[model samples]
Target: MELIDSAARAQQALEGELGGERMILNMGPSHPSTHGVLRIVLELDGEEIVNAWPDIGYLHRGDEKIAENMTYTQFIPYTDRLDYLAPLANNVAYAYAVEKLCGIDVPPRCKYIRVICTELARISSHLLGIGCFGMDVGAMTVFLYTFKEREKIYDLAECISGARFTTSYTRIGGLANDMPPEFLPMLRKFLNELPATIDEVDKLLTRNKIFVERCRGIGVISKEDAIDLGLTGPNLRGSGVEWDIRKAHPYGGYENFQFDVPVGTAGDCYDRYLCRMEEMRQSIRILQQAADQMPDGPWNAPEAKIVLPEKKAVLTKMEELIHHFINVTQGINAPPGEVYFSAENPKGELGFYIVSKGGGAPHRLKIRSPSFVNLQAIPVMAKGHLVSDMVAILASLDFVMGECDR
Candidate 1:
C-alpha cells in the first residue's frame, strides 16, 4: 500500500512537470549495459528521451580521504581500485606525483620500465573497453577476441609485477623490481600479434551496417561542448581535439618516443571507438620503441632514503638496516610542497594532486579522475536520442564506475 502511494507521488510529480504524455523511467543503478552502478533518470515521450539526468556515487570508496591516513607508498594499492582496468597506470601516476613532490628523479632504466608497464596497461585497458563496448552493442565475438588478447597482456603483467590484476609495481623513485628476462620476449610476441587482431575487430565492426547505424552520428558531442565539459582521452579526441596528456605534458620518458595521436572529426560513438582502436596501435609503437632503446642501468634510484636499499646491503650494513627500518616505519620524509601530476591513462588523464608537509603521509590528496569528469557530458549527449542510444553513448564514453565515483 505504501509502495503504491510512493509510486503515485512520483508519477504525480513527474506528470506535474512533464504533462501526462511524458513518462519518467529509471534506466539503471544495476542494469548490465550501464557498466556499473549508474542510475539515469529519463524523461521520455514514448521512446524518445526528452531529458536525461545521471545520478552517480554508487561506487565511491573515499579514496582521496583514505590517502590522508596512509603513507605515500602505502597508498599505491588503493589507486589500483580506481579504474581497476588500468591498475599499472594508476600506480605509476600516483608514484610519479609523489616523486615529483619529493624531487626524486627515477633512473633511466626505471623510466623505460614504467613506460613499458604503462603502455602495456593501455593496450590491456583499451582491449577491455573495445570488447565491452562491442558487447554492449551486441557484438559478442569482438568481446571474445579482445578478451583473448587481454589475457595475454595480463600474463605479461603478472610476469613483471608478480600480480595479474592489482599490480602495485611502481615505487616512489623506481619500480618494485626490474622486469624479468623472459618478460620482453613475451611482450614482443604480444605486440607482434596485436595489430592483426585489431584489424580483424575493425573489419568486423567498423563497417557493419548494424554497428554503423547504431554508433555513427549518434551521441554526438561537439568539439566546443566537449572542451567545455573537460573531456579527455579518446572521448575528447573523438571530438577532434588533439590534447593527449602524454604528448602535451610528456611524462615518463614519453618525449623520447614518437607516435601519432589519433583524432576524430565527428565526435560521435563511432569516432570514439575508432580512436581507442588506433590508440592501441600507437601504444604498441611506444612499447617497441622503449624496448629497442631501453638503457642498461640501475632500475631504482641510489637514494637509500627515498628508495629501499638492496636486501644484501640492509643485511650487511647497520646504516642500511636503520634506513630500511625508518623508511618502513615512518615512510620517506618528503619536502613540504604541493604538486599535481597527471598521466595519460587508458581511460583519460589520471591525475594526482598531493600536498605534503614534510611527512610520510600526505597532508591532503586529491584525484582528478577522468571518468568522473567525462560522465558529466552524458546528459548533453543522450538528450533527444532514443533510450537505446543512451547505451551506445555510455559504452563509447568508456567510463569505469570505480574511477567515476572515486
Candidate 2:
C-alpha cells in the first residue's frame, strides 16, 4: 500500500473506533507542571494521546548572536545561563572551545579541578531535574530529598566559585580562580555521603509499584531512534546506547578517569531516571579520584598576555601593570581560526563552536546546546502517550529553557 493510503486507513480506523470523540489539550507555556517554558499540543482520545506537537522558543534569549559581539572572556558568563542547573558544564564547554581555538593546554592540576567542578555540576543538575520530576509525579518527598542533596552540592559550588547558579569561574585557558583549602575536604564529605543518599532515593522511587507503573513502559525510544534524533546524555543511555562524550571524545583529561557509563535496556521514564541516578554516583567517583590525585601548580594557564594578572602582581610590579592593562583594556586577541569543542555536560553534549578573526573578540560563536537538541525528541516520544505521562516524559527529558532558547 502507498504510504499516504496506509496513514489514511490507520486514521480512518482510529477515528471509527473512537467515534470521532478526540480532545485537544495544551500542556504548557506557563503550566507549573512544565519544568520550564514549554508547550505541548496534545491530540487525545479520552486519556490516551493520539498525537503531540511541541511548541518551543518561549524562552529564547539569542545568546549565540550576543556572543558574536562580545569578547571571548565576556561570553563565558553568558554560557552559565544556559543550563543553570549545571552552570559549570556551560563554563567548561565555552572554555574548551576558546582553549582549542587558541591551542591552550591546561596544567594537570587545573584539569583535575575542572573535573571536580564539572562532576559536581553534573550531580547538581541531576538532583534538581530528577527531584522535580518526582514532585511532578506526586512524590513530593523525593523532590525535597533531592533538593537537600542538591543544596549541599550548590553550597560546595559557592564555596569554590562564590556563586551557585551562574558560576562563570572557568576562563579561556583554565579557571578564574584556584581551589581553596576547605573545598576539597567538604567535597570529600559529600562524596562519602552521596552513595547513601542515592540509595535512599532509589528505594523511595525506583522500586515503588506506583512509580514503576507510571514510568517503566511509557516514553520508550529505541536506540536507533535516539541516535537518529541526536539525543544524548541519560536519555540516549536509557535507550541502551553507551555513547558518552567524556568517553567518546575525552576532552579536559576525562580519559584519566575510571568510571562506568551505565546503560538501561528499556527506553522509558524509569530507565532515564535510573541512568541519571547511576550518573550521579559515577560523577562522585570521578570527583573522589580527582581530589585524591590533584597536582600542585598554578590553576590558570601560564600565559601572561591571555590570562589575567594576579592582583598582588599588578600592585607590586610595573610590568604586571602593563600586562593587566593590555589584557583587560584591549582583551585577548585569539588567532584567526575556528574550533568546535564538546564536553560531557550534565544535559548532554554541550559544545561550542568559536570563530576567531585574530581580534580581541570572537567573530562568531555558536553553542550546540544539549537541551535544545534533547527537547527535539519530545514530539516523537510524547505522541500517543497519556497526557499525565507527558509531564513524566518532560521531566525525564530534563530540558533547560535557558539552553534551549539560547
Candidate 3:
C-alpha cells in the first residue's frame, strides 16, 4: 500500500468510527489564519486533526546573505525589516554583536534608552499577539481593544524617533539622538494609563468560558519537547521554564532592570496568552524604572572614525566635512572578527552573528530569528488535535513569516 493511500485509509476508518468525513487540508502559504506565509498540511477526520506538517520559506529574502556584503553598522537598517513589529530589538541585537567584537561599553543613559525602547517594542508585540490570537478565535472585538492600545505605543515610539515603525534609533555605541524633553512626561502618562487598558482586555477574554475551553488543554507540549523544538519567548515560558535572555544572559544592561519572569504550568495556548499578559505588565514596570533613572550623556560613541561627525562641525571644519562625507559614502570599517549576540525580543531570542574582515563590509552574517525557531514546534503541537484547534495552535505559536523566512 502507498503511504498516501494507507494514510487516507486510516483517516477514512477513523472518520467512519466518528460518523464524519475525512480530508487533507493545507492551512496556509496564503491563508490569513496562518498569520504569515506559513503552510500547515493537516490530515483531518471531520474537524479532528490526525497530523500536521509545517511548510516554511515562502517569504525568504536572503537577508543573511545580503548582510555579508554590507558593513556591520550598515546592516542595522536591514535588521528593521525582520520581525517588523519589533525592529529595535533586531537593531539592538546586531549592534550589540558589533560592539561585543569591538569591546566598547555603551553609556548608562544609552543603556536606559535601549531598555525603554526594547520594552516598548515588547508591549507593542504582545498587543499584536493578543489581538491576532483573538482574531483567530473569531473574536473581532478583542482585536480592536488590543490594537487600540498598540496604537498608543506606536505613537509614543514615533514621538521619540521621527518614525513610528522601523525606527532605526540604535547606533553602534548608543542611540541616534537624545530623547526629547517632552518624551519622558508622555511615556509617564502612557505607563499610568496602560494597566487599566490591560485589565479591560483580561476581562473580555481571560476568564471567558468559551475562550478558556478552546485554549486550556489544547496543543499541550511538555517542557522537554518545547526545549527540544527550540521554543522561546512566551512559548517556552508557557511550558513552566523561566528562560529569558534578559534575565538569563543579561545583555544591554538588562541585569540592572528589576522585573519578574512569568511562567505557566501547562504548556498550552491559554498559558501562552497569560504569559504574554504578565510580560506586558513587566515591560511597563521596567520602562517606569528606566524612565526615573535615565542619566545624561552624549548619545553616540565618541569615535570620530566610526561615528559620524556633528553637523555643526561638518559645516565649520573642513576635516569634519571630509570625514562625514567619507563615513556616509563608504560606511564604518569594522575589525576582522566574528561575534554572536542575542536579545530578549518579545517573540523569543533574536540573535545576530556577524563575521567582519577589517573592512567596510562584513565577511559573513547570519541571523537566529525567534519566529523561525518558534514556528518549528507547530507540527508537534498540532498533531492529534482537532482541525479546528489548528488555528488555536498557530495563534499560540505566533509565527511571523518576515522573521521566519528572512
Candidate 4:
C-alpha cells in the first residue's frame, strides 16, 4: 500500500508540473537508433520535444574501481572496452597516463609509431561514425563505402597488435612490438586509395538536397553552450571552436605532424558530420607525414626496470629470465604521485587520471570518457527539435555507450 501510494505521488508530481498537457515518451534503453542501450525520457507536446533526460549506466562495469585491484599494465585491455570503436587510441591514452605517473619516456621511434597508430584509429573510428550516421539518416551506400575502407585499417591493426578490435598494443614504456616490415607498404597503398574514396563519399552526400535538408540547421549547438557543457573532439570543432588536444597539448609527437584542424560555421548536425569527414582527410595527412618521417630505433624505453626483457633473451639468459619474471609478476613500480593525461579521441578527449602510492597498481584511477561528457549535450541539442530530428542530433554527437556508461 505504501509503495503504491509513493508511485501515485511520483506520477502526480510529474504530470502536475507539465499541467497534464505533455506526454512522457521513453525513447530507448534497447532501441536500435539510441545507439547503445541509452534511454532518453522525452517530455513531448505532440511532435515537438519539450525536454529530454538521458538515462545511462546500463553497461557500467565499475572500470575505475576495477583499476585499483589490477596492475597498471594489466589495465590496458580494459581501456579497449571503453571505446570499442577506437581501442588503439584508448590504449595509447591509458598507457601514456601510466607512463606519466611513472616518469617513463618512451623512445622517439616509439612516439612516432604511437602517433601513427592513434591517427589510424582516428580515421577508422570516423569512417564508422560517418557511415553509421549516414545510414541513420537513410543513406545506405555510404555505409558500404566506409566499411570497405575500415576493413583495411583493421588489417593494419592486426598486423601491429595481432588483434583487430581490442588491440592492447601499448605498454607503459612503449608498444608490445614494433610495426612489421610489411606494415608500411600496406599503409602506403591504403593512403593512396583512401583519398579517392573520401572524395566519392563527399560527392555522394555533401551536396545531396535530401541529405542537406535533413541535417543542416537541425540540432544546433552554439560555441558558448558547447564549451560550458565541456564538449570536445569533432563535436566541439563542429561548433566552430578551434580547440584540438593534438594542436593545443601536443602529445605523442603530434606536434611534429603537419595537419589542419577543421572547424564548422553553422554548429549543426550537418556541420558535425562535415567536421568528421574533413577530419578523416586530416588524419590521412598526418599518417602520410608520420610514415615519411618514420624513424628506426628502439621501440621501448631503455629503462630495463620498467620494460619487459625480450622473450628470446629471457629464455637464453638467467639475468634476463629473472628480470622478466619479476616485471611480469610484480609490474612496473610507479612513483607516488598523481597525473592526468588525455588524448584527442574520435568522440572527444579521452582522459585518464591516476593516483599512485609508489606501487605497481594505482591507488585510485578515474577515466574521463568523452562519450560520457559529450552525451551531456544531447538534452541541450534535442530540446525544441522535432522527434524526427533527434536521430540526426544523436548521430552527430557520435557517442558510444561503452565509453559513456563506463
lDDT of each: 0.91, 0.87, 0.85, 0.91
Give candidate 1 regions above 4 Å deviation: 1-20
- Model 3: how far is 295 from its true place, Å? 0.6
lDDT-sorted candidate list, best first: 1, 4, 2, 3
Q: Which stretches of candidate 4 lie over 4 Å from their true place?
A: 1-20
lDDT of 4 by residue, 206-248 (tens): 9988889989999899999999999999999999999999999
Which lDDT value does model 1 have at 352? 90
Q: How many residue pairs clash in each candidate?
A: 0, 0, 1, 0
Off by over 4 Å in 2: 1-18
Report the alpha-carbon TM-score of model 1 versus the true structure: 0.94
For candidate 2, write residues 1-406 as lDDT tens digits: 5556777867977778635588888888998777789887888877888888888899898898888877788888898899888888788777878888888888888889989888998999998888888888888888888888988988998998999778898987878888889999998898888888888989999988888888988898998999999999999999999999899888888999999999999899999999999999898889989999999988888888787777889999998899888877777888998888888888888878888889888888888888889888987887778888988899899888888888
TM-score of 2: 0.94
Model 2 worst lDDT window (10 residues) = 1-10
Q: Which candidate number would show the highest lDDT if scored against the true structure?
A: 1
Residue pairs that clash (backbone atoms under 3 angstroms), model 2: none
lDDT of 2: 0.87
Estimated TM-score per prediction? 0.94, 0.94, 0.93, 0.94
Residue 199 lDDT (model 2): 88
What local lDDT score does residue 297 receive in model 4, on the 0 to 100 scale? 89
Check candidate 4 and list the clashing pairs: none
